[model samples]
Target chain A: SQTIHQWPATLVQPVGSPLSLECTVEGTSNPNLYWYRQAAGRGLQLLFYSVGIGQISSEVPQNLSASRPQDRQFILSSKKLLLSDSGFYLCAWSDYQETQYFGPGTRLLVL
Target chain B: QQQVKQSPQSLIVQKGGISIINCAYENTAFDYFPWYQQFPGKGPALLIAIRPDVSEKKEGRFTISFNKSAKQFSLHIMDSQPGDSATYFCAASTGSGGSNYKLTFGKGTLLTVNP
Candidate 1:
């Protein structure tokens, strides 16, 4: 069985601060990873996705960026956070079948 | 051409009643359709999925009806329970090619099954 883990389940950051969220998957290798943000009571917005290490694709242009530093480790980072950046960030992994499994998620609140 | 539209932004149903959510796509190239269920403050989980080749697929109390000609698909929940009260999102993708399963998700429907 595979499991996904995310850190800082919840975070409160002040405006103009930096942001970093990590996601790691176990029991699988060479899996595709994705980053998405869900606004309050709204649909999910895809931010970035990676096929392999050092390869990342941006679905939407914004202040956030994603990186696949390791086969099973993915990180979402931002040099400076904006008020609009506050939302529920999610990390997902998929195999050949492309059925994505998501992690518990990180809720960031910018004040 | 890559857009998926869903209806009924919110729904309220009685326990043991039927719950239905509809989704339509404009891109005929889309071959894969999936539905996800998300609880408050959590990530969406894959609930059921159907391909264009199948007209309908059922799993336990959940069913996915795919209409190839209509470019539409729907999810049906039988004997809905309070536990089923959550946000449902419908998504569609063109193919399973490497790094191409970019799913376009619907706005999501908030289902509340009253006990």
Candidate 2:
């Protein structure tokens, strides 16, 4: 069975601070990884997706960026966080563009 | 442009009642439709999915009705329970090629099953 793990399940940061969220999947290789942000009472917004290592496609133009360092390791980072950047971030993986499996998610609050 | 649209921003149903959520899409190129259930503070989980080729698909107590020509689909929950209370999101995606791998999500519906 495949399992996805995310770190710092919850975080509180001040404005202009750096942000880093990690996502790793075990038991799968060369899987499609995606980064999504869900604002309160709003639909999910796709931030980034990667087909392979070093290849990242950004869906929205924002301060956040995503990188797939290893086959199953994806990271979402930001040089400086904004108040609008606060939301629940999710990491998902799909095997052939079929169903996507999401991680536990990281809740970030920028004060 | 929102590719997919879902109705009933919020729904309150008593236990043992039926819960229905409707979703519509404008893009004819979309071939895949999926419904996800999300609990508070948790990630959305794939509950059920249907393709354009199928008119309807049922899994356990959950069912997905797809109308190809109407470009609409819906989810039906039979004998709803309190555990079913959660936020439901409907999503659609095109399988063409390239960046089409991403799924466009709806605004989401908050379902509350009163016990």
Candidate 3:
């Protein structure tokens, strides 16, 4: 069985502060990882995706960035947080089938 | 452009009643359809999925009915329970290649099951 771990489960950051969220998957290798932001009562907005180490694609232009340091470790970071960054951030991964399994999600609140 | 359009921004259903959510897509290239269920402050979980080749697929109380020509699909929950109350999203993706499974999700429907 595969599991995805993301932390911190919840965070409160002041405006213009640096931010980092980590996601790691177990029981799979070379999986495609994705970062998605969900607005309140809305659907997901794809932020970034990584096919492999050091390879990242920005689906939407914003302040956030993603990196794949290891085969199963993905990180979402921002040099300076924006008020608009407050939302639910989810990390997901898929194998050949692309049936994504999501993490518990990080609830970010930028005050 | 929105690849998928879902109806009923929110729905309220009484327990033991039927719950139906509909989704339509403009891209005919989509070959796979999936429905996800999400609770408050949690991630969306895959509930049921269907292929264009199949008209309908059912798992327990959840069923996905796909209409290829119509470019539409629907999820039906039988004997809905309070536990079924949550947000539902319908998504579509094409699997032409091994990596073409990038999902495009709908706005999502909030289903409220009243006791």
Candidate 4:
């Protein structure tokens, strides 16, 4: 069975700080990876998606960026975080069927 | 622009009652439709899905009804339970395989099944 992992499960940071969130999938190779953010009581917003290593597509212009350093490893980063950047970050993986499976997610709080 | 639109921003239903959520799409190229259920602070999970070729598909207590002519689809939960209380999302996408497909999701509906 395939599983996805993300960390830290919860994060708290001051404004203007750097941000880094990691996502890794096991039991699958060359899977499509995606980054999404959900604000409080809001819908999911696609931030970035990658087809392969070093290939990333930005769905919307925002303060965050994504990188696929490895086949199953994806990272979401920001040089400086804004108050609006705080939200629940989700990592998802999918195969050719277009059915996406999600990770536990990371909750970031900016003060 | 929002390609998929879902109705009922919030719903409250008593236990054992039926729960229904509706979604409509404008894009005719979309061949895949899926519904996701999300608990508080958790990632959304795929609950059920239906292809355009099928008018209705049922699995266990969940069912997906697709109306190709109206460009609409809906999810029905029979005998709704408190455990079914969660946020539901509807998504549609074009293409079938590979990394070429991207899903356009609805704003989401919060469903609360009172016990």
Per-prediction TM-score of chain B?
A: 0.96, 0.95, 0.95, 0.95
Off by over 4 Å in 3: none
The global Cα lDDT (0 to 1) of model 2 is: 0.92
Q: Residues A1-111, candidate 3, lDDT per residue (tens digit)? A: 899999999999999999999999999988899999998888988888888888899899988989999999999999999999999999999888868888999999999
Would you list the C-alpha lDDT of every candidate in the order shown? 0.92, 0.92, 0.91, 0.93
- List ranges where model 4 is wrong by over 4 Å: none
lDDT of 3 by residue, B1-115 (tens): 4479998899999999999999999988787788999999999999998888899999999999888888899999999999999999999877658663578999999999999
Write down the worst ten-residue block by lDDT for model 2 chain B: B93-102
Clashing pairs in 4: none
TM-score of each: 0.98, 0.97, 0.98, 0.98
Candidate 1: the clashing residue pairs are: none
Per-model fnat list: 0.75, 0.66, 0.66, 0.75
The CA lDDT at A102 in model 3 is: 87
Under the 3 Å rule for N, CA and C atoms, how many clashes does model 1 have?
A: 0
Give the docking tier of candidate 1: medium
Q: What is the TM-score of chain A alone in each candidate?
A: 0.98, 0.98, 0.98, 0.98
The runs of at least 3 residues in candidate 2 whose Cα sits more than 4 Å from the true structure, single-residue gaps closed, are: B96-100
Best by lDDT: 4
At residue B16, candidate 3 shows an lDDT of 96
Residue A88 C-alpha lDDT in model 3 = 98
